[model samples]
Target: MDTSEFNHGHGGEPINWERAAGDNAFVFMKATQGTRYKDPWFAEDFAAASRTSLLRAPYHFFDPQSPYDAGAQARHFARTARAAGYTGQKPGELPPVLDIESALVNHRAACPPHTDARQVAALLRHIEAEFGVRPVVYTNHSFVTLCLAGDARILKGYQQWLPAYQSEPPRLPGTGRDWAFWQYTDRARVPGIPGPVDRSVYHGSLQELRSMAGIRGNPPER
Candidate 1:
């Protein structure tokens, strides 16, 4: 599930992490955005997920228009995630993520002029240095088509989390690279989550997923 402070259970109840674990393999939580604005729900939600069998991770919402540079944002994200207990070396903990999309910010319109591949690449590199593992990239077709021109050599090594809602798996807009994780739906109804939630699938086997989290051996029992 891809969740931020905005998502809530029925009647604004907190999500039942135990219930979520029963239905899902992993949980991606929003940690930080730009150079500040840490998700209010992130620390609590990430800690709650730790007790469950679910693999948990954090993502940063990249803002190319921010006054701070990519390095500052990366540092802020890494610090916030570290404070939230995401070490990336722990069991069931995946690497940090960069959420770069053509999305609105603080009631503003979508950003078309500020998107830069250099910034994205620099941010990813800084994050990888912090965690000692390759970070993940969460993006969509529109952003790629509008900003990245469908091909970014800098993105080749990082895992791609493509959100394309359709029956068929999505091809990475211009790169023709296979998606590592696919967010197939935003209206998925799981037992633990009251409102609609985004759900995604990992392309490889359970073992491969564990490996990505720096874990070895069999999948953790739920």
Candidate 2:
């Protein structure tokens, strides 16, 4: 599960971390937007999730159209995530996520009129360089096909978090490639998270999930 500032304000309710953990939900929360905004509840929410023993990651909302340099945005995300207690030292914890979606284009006034795959690549490179592990790429199939023009080969080394809210699985762009995490529905009713929430499933076992996150040992006999 993942959440953003939009999910922390008036219309949103605080997450019941204990309940979520009990449900075996690993949580990822948005920590920054572009190169400017920071999610206000990041500190509190991150700490709460950690205390509940939930595997956690902090994601950045990438805006290729933003005037800010991709490198700068990457630096901001790294800084914000670190401050929020993501040390990138534990394999049990997920690496950062880069969320690129069509909504970035829909908000044209704030973002540029066009999307740049190169800039997106730059963001990915910077994060990987800073953290020593590749960040997960979260995007939909259409955005990958249209905006990226099916040219996101730069992200081939990283895990893909594809969101296709339908009965069937998502159709990936590149051949011989598959999703590591699939956000299958946005109307899921999970315990602890108030109202509807986006729900995702990992492609493998708990041990595989840990390995993908860069953890090397067998999962602690949980």
| The best candidate in terms of TM-score | 1
User: 1-222 in candidate 1: lDDT tens per residue?
Assistant: 889877875456687888888978888999998887898889988989899878889999997555338888888999999998898889789878899888665865354545677777788888889888788898876676656766655677678998878664666644557888889999998777678899999999888988877778997664
List ranges where model 1 is wrong by over 4 Å. Answer: 9-12, 66-68, 104-110, 173-176, 220-222
Q: Write the per-residue lDDT of candidate 2 for residues 68-177, one digit (tens) a residue.
A: 48888889998998887886666557888999876544544222334667777888889888788888888776666666776667667778888877654554555347
**lDDT (C-alpha) at residue 111 in model 1:** 46
lDDT of candidates 1 onward, in order: 0.82, 0.76
Model 1 TM-score (2 dp): 0.90
Lowest-sum lDDT 10-residue window in model 1: 107-116
What is the Å distance of residue 177 in model 2 from its true position? 0.9
Worst ten-residue run, lDDT, model 2?
104-113
For model 2, what is the error of residue 9's alpha carbon versus the real structure, in angstroms, after optimal superposition? 6.2
Residue 157 of model 2: what lDDT? Answer: 74
